[model samples]
Target chain A: MKKTALLIIAVLGILLLRAAEDLPFWGDPQSPASVHLSDYYLEESYEETSVPNIVTSVLADYRGYDTMFETVVIFCAGITVLIVLRRTHRRRAKVISPRPERPGADIILQTAARLLVPMMQLFALYVVAHGHHSPGGGFQGGVILGSSLILLALSYDIQMALHRFKEKLVLLFSAGGVLLYAAIGLACLFLGRNFLAYGAWAALLGISEPEAHSHGMLGVEIGVAITVLCIMFSLYIDLASGGDLDEGL
Target chain B: MEDLLAYIISRYNYWAAIILLLIGLYGMIAKNNLLKKVIGMTIFQAAIILFYVSIGDKRGATIPILAHGHDGAHQAVEAAAYANPLPHVLMLTAIVVGVSTLGVALAILQKIYRVHGTIEEDEILETIDQ
Candidate 1:
């Protein structure tokens, strides 16, 4: 079976190589990808959104519907893990470990994490906030934020992290993140505008139309960061400890 | 052979993606372990992402962040000045989705292990047959 698989792979590789012959050369300026809506996005993003980062403007403003659904997808994934793993009627065994067992074992890692976690969270916030003019956005920033919490779990243990972030609180924050995003949209609608029409806030925020778009993008990015941070940490706690929220590796 | 080499040189990214796809495909087809297959699936997914990103590349272009001058001078914006941002945006979301999927997959695998006591495909099949 392994030999047959090897043969199949070779054949497939050759076939793909032939197909590659048809693709445009790397970095071709006139390639269909760059010729399509990308040029428009590149040209008009700043004028429309007052944000320097074309990618963030496109992701958060132009294609917002896609982002909204993706947020829902992550939320659903977190909830799925909760449903599948959490032991509600566990007459089995609890995986609890209250004491530190040995405080000095991971002294180096603990100290390093203590030093690094704050900086990581700060950088994550920067990435989220400065996404307008840089190569980052809420998704990248949220992952970094989530990793800091995961690092906190790894350095000390799950219980230490859980002390600050209760499951109930995490759930609320996770749900609330999505709610904040929807609320912004609904607010726009209430003001006699379309859902997520951030220009509606131009008058309220006392900013120009383009500036309002920037502010709106910032708001949505914050909402995305909150959801991603909560969901990622919640998912990690569940997956690492099999939903027990106790002693985890 | 020289023509093929030239073509390969010009489109190396696609060729590399194909090689990665092959490696991932082999792992999925030949491996008996479920976890290995999951890793293979990840590799396959990564190859696809690589292809999309490579397709979006533009020679001599800066990052997707538009250049700004604070002096209030209206410089003409050129499309070729920056790399295509669409793929970057799409792939960013894709990466997040990929991570979410991987987490769910690992969680499901844990459940499968707890229930089946093993994570080998043939072993699970045998148990089911018995």
Candidate 2:
């Protein structure tokens, strides 16, 4: 009864709040939002840094400082996952598998995995590569890749999936991605520019003028995508591994 | 009045996203079950993604591609007509962040479940006290 009353009151409060705000509920053709962010990119962004892909420009150049921290956060997660999932050499015997197989899950799963895994992996690669031009990108592509493994785990047993690809590799890849990003930043520092400065790389790589910025940004975007993908995989392993119970260390 | 209704109907995605977000928040605050909390978290994250996608919308814009026209030069279009890729870019990062945080929370919840054997917040508290 109290829950019902609270729910009603909450609904009323929400409605009142919506009524009070004069926010545009629909897409207004004349609104400030209709302007393509590209205009800002073409005019201001190019002058500041000459990257062609504005998203990459913003991520790698304009806001690379934030991105450094974002990379660090992902690294923190990878470390945490490692810490939580780490198994001591002797304690490997105590690591219990979650579910015991009943009957013919093996034959059925083998047939399905044979057909599905290749197609999913191909799609993920397409998403990663075509990200600069389309609605998809490294993060989305990475999740798709990570979730494909999840599809495997649900269909097959966890032991089979773990055997196919170790979590240690995923953690290593994730850490490597972050290290690559920092290395780029450090490289920029060596070249006498700010951390993650693309201009410095352009000069070092002998990339001239406008194209230099584009290539530099692309490199960083690759870094971002890799980190995002590995982090997503790490997250999946953490969640789907039944809370890392009995994994010593 | 008819036009007003049409406008509202046309942009139902944003409305739905906002509604979902509110509903998720309400559930998060009101529900006592840890499972329900996770459900709310998913709902909220998905709603936020919807909101971000809506922000990327431009009425008649195509994907911002620098494809060549018949002349083999970059086809120029009105700047106002291109979708804002910034929101999508930011949202992509946010989605990954959301998943990671949820993974950590769910991991901790598993530990809690193991220790207490009940997923209800109130029940756990009661058990702890006793």
Candidate 3:
């Protein structure tokens, strides 16, 4: 079976290589992928949305609907994991041995986490907020924020992390983030524009259309960050504790 | 021979991505341990992401972020001066979705281990047959 699998993979790889012969050379500026729509996004994204970061503008503004659904997909995955693994009552024999208890929380680790978590969170916020002008953005920022909590869980215990950020609150934040994104879209709708049309917000916010686009993108990015942050930490605690919400790795 | 070598060198990034993809496919297909399979899936995802980001690259271009003057003057944005942003934006979604899928897969694996008392695919299959 293993040999057959290897043979199939070899054939597949060869076919892929054959197909690559027709593709554009690496980093060709005139490649089809670089020309068709990408050129438009690069040339006009700044003037259209006032976001210097073309990727951010394209992701959160030009493709707002796609991003909204992407957030929903993440939210659904988190909830699926919770439903699949979470055990409310322990009736059956434990399949895995409980993690051995450490004597106590290591002072050095706790102290370092204490010092690092705040800095990490602050940096994450900066990444989310400064995404328009720089490299950082909602998803990257949210992952950073999530990792800070994971680091706290790793240094101390899952219970401690959960105590600080309760499971209920995590779920709430995850849902709330998606709601916030949709609410912005709905607000645009009620203001006499299509769903997710940031230009409609200009009248209400007393800003130019481009500035409204920028603010709308920022608002949705924050929503994405909030959902991602909560869902990431929630996934860690659930998986680390084998869905019991008890002690974790 | 010289022409062939030049061609290969120019397309090395795609070659690398394909090689990584095959390795991932092999692991996913042949590994008996469920956890190893999950790791393989992750590698597969990383390979695809790399391939996409590669497509967005330009030989003599900066990143997609527009450059502004120190005095806040807007210059004419040239399409050739910056790498493509579309693929990067799409891959951002791919990456977040990948992580979410990994979480769900790991959770399901944990549940499987709990029920079957093993994570080996063969062992689980045998138990199911019995």
Off by over 4 Å in 2: A1-16, A19-21, A33-38, A42-53, A82-103, A243-249, B10-14, B68-72, B75-77
lDDT of 2 at A192: 92
Error of 1 at A107 (Å): 2.0
Query: Deviation in angstroms for B78 in model 1?
Result: 0.4
Task: Give the range of the ten consecutive residues with the poorest summed lDDT in model 1 chain A.
Answer: A91-100
- Write one digit per residue (lDDT tens) for candidate 2, span A1-249: 338746864785578456525545444444455455446753455445543345656666677777767767766876676566544557656555444334656677778886898798789888766655545655666677777776766676555666767767767777777777788878878989878776786666776645556565556666766777667655665556554522211
- Candidate 3, B1-130: lDDT as tens digits: 9999888777899999999999898889999999999999999999999899989999899998998764656878999999999999999999999999999999999889888988999999999999
Clashing pairs in 1: none
Model 2, range B1-79, lDDT digits (tens) per residue?
A: 9998886665677667767877777677778888888888889889889876776666676664433333423444456
RMSD (Cα, Å) for all candidates, in order, is 2.9, 4.1, 1.6
By TM-score, the best candidate is 3
Best by DockQ: 3
- Between prediction 2 and prediction 3, the one with superior TM-score is 3
Model 1: reference contacts kept, as a fraction: 0.82
Winner on lDDT (1 vs 3): 3
